[model samples]
Target: MTKTTFTGQRHPAASTEAENSVNKVPTETTMNQGGDSSHLSFQLTSHKLNGKNYLEWAQSVRLAIDGRGKLGHLTGETKKPEPGDPKMNAWRSENSMVIAWLLNSMEAAIGKPYLFLPTARDVWEAVRETYSDVENASQIFELKIKLWKVRQGERGVTIYYNEMVSLWQELDQCYNDEWECPKDSVKAMKKEENERVYLFLAGLNQEFDELRSRILGKNPLPTLRETFSEIRREETRRNVMLKLDSNLEGKNIDSSALVTAKNENDKKKKPWCDLCKKYWHTRETCWKIHGKPPNWKKKGADNRGSQAFQSSSEESGLQPSLEVPPFTKEQLELLHKLLQSQLQTSKLDPSTPTCSFSQTGQGLGEDDWQC
Candidate 1:
């Protein structure tokens, strides 16, 4: 809008007093300074966009970046875990913008823990680009809230989430809660986990008589979850080993927890040896059968004080020949979280009452046991 003013002195005309008439240009609104409304109109035509469009739309998000200059995520975003330097857990507590975005990303995608590591980086970038503009776009600052409904088509284990999201939800809830899943399903997963573990241990055995016949023909393919589980177990085993070593140097390394050893002549049979052809020995004591000299020390073998025991005529001291694997910090954290959540949920379960027969049967003799 323009300001209008009438000058006091008017031009004098000869016949009649003629007043000057002029029109002031209508003022332009601030919206015309930088052309944006036009492009915004075009942007609304598309409902679903790709990663590129998503990034462009980020410039319109509302930002509350702190003194550190990090921006908050869109309101409708589901949170994801912050996959950062493992040592930065404590650091993130003071950085709410990072944590909040991570959480939103996780929630939005229902992402698996393994998937979050890579997605976390993109999430932060998305939040930053979404909030570049401070005004005129606040109404659409938040990400779109597109939703979908799950419907059934056919029954099978091979269907994708788009077809079976609801079924998985029922199973996934057990991640934290101990609800009763169908016995068949629980039994099946447990059986699968155990069978996978057994096959893995069997594969580790160096002296399987028919490794090719049993394994190569079977064509077993390890799953992402199974591989992850084994990786975690081995890692925890390594951690326990390291902790034991740090606390027990100069002490005997106990193999009981790791592997059991016993003589065949003992009351019960012990786990057999791969190298030895005897009943009373393990792979550790198999030198007697392998015909190796008692003092024999294999080259490149772990010699963790095994030399302290002098070899007989040809018995090498037992040592760990297998390479130990290390665990990632995230795996350790996941295990700890799983255990803690399980423990908390277990304590919340109602106890089953037990009744004794002796406490019942008023009409019966005191000597009778009847409920």
Candidate 2:
């Protein structure tokens, strides 16, 4: 050895290489090298293996995987290689990623069993084997019975239709494709469609009878979705009409109450006088206008004469005379006694000659003045 080449520090080239390695950006493969890395920005659809909803759960999970572009991994289409194969590590890495996705998509309570499965395909197969069609006939029969009993009770057309749709989807999931021939499949599909239409029509509330008939009467019958939309619009129209009617009724009630209150107030505030044809005072208090005095007939001669005099005066624009009431018999007797006393005093005192009594034929008689 030509003297061992030793230095206090590493070569510049080695140092540069180390620096470059430290500064390198992670590639997609390296970022996902850990088999269970998740890159999704959202949570996946969750499924539960609660024994009764296996079909629905499986369908939902399958849809979830397909939506995320990882259906191939779950279906065994993108298969993982066996151990010791050249691409075994890569295969296992991808398979592990798929298995992690599936595990995340399961509900916590029922997901414990499938958590340790090696591959997504294995997990799917295990779940399917356990809950696929254990009681195919009975399950299908029960689903059919439920579909048959489905009704619109209390729910609006839209809600009822959505419920029916869920039942139909569940019924469809129960079908097995292995034993279905093209003829039987087509026939079954048509029959199911017919049943669906019938169920939808039958379940509708009576308010939608005419619409239901119209939908059924179409040349090529409308799909369940189209029918549902039509019924929703009808419901909206009914609601609007009901609101209008309610508003009208409220207005009417308010108007009637106001009228009644106004009438009552008018009655209380101003009583009517029928005799005067006026509203200020009642007939009882309007005696001056409507009633005659009880002694009017006894005082009629003076009253008539006074009325005639007033009429003449009013016609000629002269001053009116004062009116007087007729006197009673006792007053006349007192007047006669006073006049007799005056005569006796005149007799005693001769200074004043005795005045003679004279009757004026033109004037009113004394009897006329007496009551």
Candidate 3:
């Protein structure tokens, strides 16, 4: 009865079970520690919360934390374990990591007070109470004003669509209401979607007028996404057409400029007449050969003719001719008598040289003229 034995080693099954328990603890701890360490420098979003953007910042943080499977820490769904519990260390470690992430995602002044908070949920609630203004009518009015004014002016369709969607999402969050009946909810959702479609169409640039009309003409109006796709396609097509039109216009302008320059050069190269001192004609076709017209003075032809005559006389070393008055009948008879008397005197005195006129009746013959 006194032969009870106590051994340092346990049964094989017991030892294996104990070893498994020890391995499981370390494995779970390592996994949690690894997860926590990986996200040590993680920022939820590029936009830091500064009280004014609390709604948007909250949405971003929720999305990021949910992605990491740690949203429960912020929502209080993941409860704190008892002090001596095996999971207590991992829970505390993960909670602390989440708190760090939240702090990092906030503005320094806005996040400092939350640094000493006990848990992530406490920090989340504190921030919410301080900045969440979902029920504020002023906020709703401001959001409505922004939505009303959003337009596609100068921005690409995708950019405009993104901005509008962001505003819609924020506005929706502000007016989140749960319906009692599924049918009513569906109907309400459809109505809201239709209203959004109208808003989107209205905010488009006038360039999309035809497409917008086509979309509105449909019996059962297209969904917002479908309308957006159609509009996006149209935008791409318009861009291509505009580029082609600009290219064609540029080519036409270049061709017209070239033609104009060529015409100017051709005019510059035309023959000039010395007799008329005018462009586009030679001495053969000058007005002097054709005889001066009646409207020469009215048409400035007399001035041109005078300039040409003056230039030609200068070149030929001759004096310009002056206009002579018409002789009256008596004056002509007197001139003829004087000429006959002078001729008779010249004949009586053969020593005087006589002058002869040329066939043109305008100048003396070269042989009859003295130097």
* lDDT (10s digit) by residue, model 2, range 84-153: 8899877776676667655665566666898888778889888778777643788779877887888887
lDDT of candidate 2 at residue 146, scale 0 to 100? 86
Instruction: Score residue 118 of candidate 3 by CA lDDT.
Output: 97
Residue clash pairs of candidate 3: none
Model 1 Cα lDDT, one tens digit per residue, 240-341: 888988777534446443344443244355566666554566876576555778688776355322222222212443432233324344664565566667
Best by lDDT: 3
Which sequence of candidate numbers ranks them by lDDT, best first?
3, 2, 1
Residue 272 lDDT, candidate 1, scale 0-100: 63
Cα RMSD to the true fold for all candidates: 41.6, 21.6, 20.1
TM-score of each: 0.14, 0.58, 0.60
Tens digit of lDDT per residue, candidate 3, span 1-371? 12111111122343343344223312233546645444445556655899788765776677667767899998889999998999998899889888988998899999999989999999999998888875678887988999999998999988787777767666665653666676777677777788889999999999899999999999899988889899999999999999999999999999999999999999779998888688988887687898666655542233443445555677778875554324444665576577667778888999976653212132222332232
* Cα lDDT, model 2, residue 57: 60
Choose 2 or 3, whichever is better by lDDT.
3
Pairs with backbone N, CA or C atoms under 3 Å apart (clashes), candidate 2:
none
